[model samples]
Target: MECNKHNQPLSLYCPSHLMPSCDVCISTSHSKCNGITSLASVVEKTKIENSKESVEKDINYFLSILDQLVTSKSKNIKTGENHCIGVKKSINEIRKEINKHLDHLEEKLCQETDIIWNQEKSKATDFISEIEGKRENLKEMKEHLQTVTTNTSKLQSFLGVHKIEQQVHQCQRYIEDLENDERTKEVDIKMKQNDEIENIIGKLVSIESVGEVSVVKTEINLNKETSLRRKAQVKSQEQSNINNMTMNIETKIKINIDKTIRDMICLIDGRFIVVDWHGKVNLLSSDGKLQKQLPIPGDAYSVTQINEDTIAITYPKERAIKIFNMENETVMKVIKLGKLCNGLSFSNNSLAVGLRKEEIRIIDLEGNTLKSIQVQSESYLYNLVYCDKRVIFSDSRGKAVYCVDDSGKQIWQYKQDLMGPEGLCIDTYGNIIVVDFNSQRIMVISKDGQDSKVLISKEEGLVFPQCICFNHNESSGFICDYYGTYLAKFNLSFG
Candidate 1:
């Protein structure tokens, strides 16, 4: 019962940390925490009849869930094994008809089948092992639960119940993650043999195997409980607004290529079409690695995804937009704009271009003008995004962000604590996330453009962050530094 550090007998419980702390601990580390009292007082205040029963009930509930997950994942392993066996049988049947010529082909197909099946099997085994580990954690706490309850000591029961309850919540989040994960679903092994291969094999001397083998992943929702749970979670967030949302940095990639990234767009397929102010247009992988670089050799300012197979990049110096086929990285057509384009955004088959003047041009992919929105600011550079029938643009010279309608009217403006604003984006919940060049931070402004919070700052290692974009699914986002060699990928989560 002595203090761990100051050697003062542990006399107080910190409900925030779910622990018993000495006086010295509370004065410093636990200063901001509330509800500090003697451990015995916690049980008295909460009016608990049986903390043991309450916590044990939660443990049992989670253990049942873990048991279900173990059974389901094991079944997927069995299903994949049976599927692979069936595929191998077909390969052998072809071998019987084609004789020894098909022997090598059959062996190769079976080996390929084993490889694919084993990969899935390993995934299931690993998942089951992890679930079992969680199960063991609950079981250990259950054993300790008896020790705490045996003496009828309020201090022991209070602390035990608190720790075990925290474990229950951890287990709940883990189960929720399993429900969202694709690996929890059934993994189907598909190896189709070409009938022509068996028929023409005897006629021809040699050929390239029977058919291609692949692991076909199904999109079926594995857990209905999870599906409904996710819907409820999303609905709960929808009840509020993005003002209640926040972000956590998930991944960081140091761009190996030396290019100044001005703006970037995340596509539906997790790829990025990024533009460099230094005359380079590159296709980047989800991790910010350079995949392919277009040979435009012009000072590109911004890029946007126009369609699944097309992208448009604006070269301010050239005063033109290049519509290129993303498949081949070749220019399909050129849409010449007489004004300098600083940023581009596409929605509803229309393009919104930010020019050097106080106008925002709405154009189509075929270079037809749709609508031009007029604003009060005549800034030289404007970076903008179009979403929900509103054009959210950043005026670099004004050091502010503005929301406008298509009919040349202003909606709202955000102009506080902003320093050298550049690229901005509207998140799924209509919150505007913008990166600042001079402030070296990122901010999340409310949809009404009234309230804003600094989501990240230079204290968080941001060095002139210029562009910020969220993925289509809203699960992840990326921030590009103005220097172009560093990108921060963040996980987007909402209450």
Candidate 2:
């Protein structure tokens, strides 16, 4: 420790002010203080006063309080959202009930209308039948009178004519009676809507809104224990500037394989999953030692971790993506694709796959596509990373890196001269760490893609650098070279 006044090393302590001081401070600030002790003696006495277990207990107590607060607040948020969803469901149920009742009333009215129509038709039909019968009777009597006049005696003709006249008179009387009856008038059907139902419908339409919800006051108890625990992955207090950072190689571990290394990813526990071009995946320890080799058949182009135990890989030749269980070392599921699939990224429980064509498909685990973005790249895109609704990928043939939105609209692109950009990863400060296969180097581009700097050169023992990944804290990282050669472990520092 140093002195604030003289800029000299501090070795003495002022007990009155509880401050450490140098010689200059002792003569100036501690001149009036009594019993100023040496800092070394004070440290020795503190070893007994502040034990390691007691300090740990104090830290644990603070952590417990913070954990409870976070859990209760998160639970309350979820509870409030669920309550809103329940209220919306109830509203839909009410609308459904009203519709059901209206449908029943409509059907009943239709049946009543039909009954009235049938009754009117029956009355009109009966009148027509009675008129026809009377007319036929009169016609038959007249024909008998004509036959007596032509072939029988005068007395017979007279009687027949008299009977025909009586029959005609009766027919005329029946016609008159039909015309006099009110039921003989032309049938006219009319419809009348119920006034009560129309008024109810108008009332419903005039109302502005459904209803309002009652608010309940919530009280959060920070001391209470919560069932849900929060995982606090606290990082170092020092912040890093993307513009001023350094990459220093710490160790280089040679791999036993000979094929080309295509892609790699850093795991949660500081391990790595690297893939060879020939369908082989190796799980390496934090120190770059081979722990296990996962038996995977077919050409694996890219790989991404869905979780600690699950991983998804794309097979170009197979035109599919296979999910593997790292714990069991078995293929759990396979998602088939019609086009050739290359790059892979797991986001929001779905895979964002880059096809050999000009399209990128977002699909679920069951191979059902959720979205497809059509890029305008002329070359084939290989490695990619998806974050913040943005898809960043590299086109090896085009020698360019692209940043595009979810709908494939261009944001910005970085083109390194004759640089074969391969796999890329995002750093803690949103900078992009991309490797160049042809240049045999590594580059860190600003998150905006407006500026870039060559972080690692080929002279630093890098041969055909293919993929790069950093740990969670960006304290250390690994750079994999092509041809399955080796993994270079490096310590990362930011100014």
Each prediction's TM-score against the native? 0.50, 0.50
Q: Model 1 over residues 1-495: C-alpha lDDT tens digits? A: 977788898888998888888889999889999878897687567746566677777677668777877887798899999999988998888777767656888898899899999989999999889879999998987887778767777887798888888888888898898888987898888867674554354324222355334465554343434211334433322233665677788778898655556678788788876776455777888777889887765777678887788888887767888887877768888888897677788888888888765568989888898897766553544478888778988876678888888887777888999887888887777888888888888888888777888777789887878788887576678888776788889876776
lDDT of each: 0.77, 0.79
Runs of candidate 2 with Cα error greater than 4 angstroms are: 1-241, 416-418
Candidate 2 clashing pairs? none
Question: Going through the candidates in order, what is the number of backbone clashes in each?
Answer: 0, 0
Please report, as a residue range, the 10-residue window in candidate 1 with the lowest summed lDDT: 226-235
- lDDT at residue 11 of model 1 (Cα atoms): 82
Worst 10-residue lDDT window, candidate 2: 222-231
lDDT tens digits by residue: candidate 2, 1-495 = 787778898899898887899999899777999999899998878876456767676678779888887998798899999999999998899889989998998899889889998998887888778768876786777677667678778888788778778878877787788677988777787777665555456435534345445465556555543323445696644333656878899888887766667689888878888887556788888877788888877667789998989999998778899999988888999899988777888778888999864788888888898888887554555788887778888876678888887777787888855378887887777678888778887888778777788788899888888888877575778888776678888776787
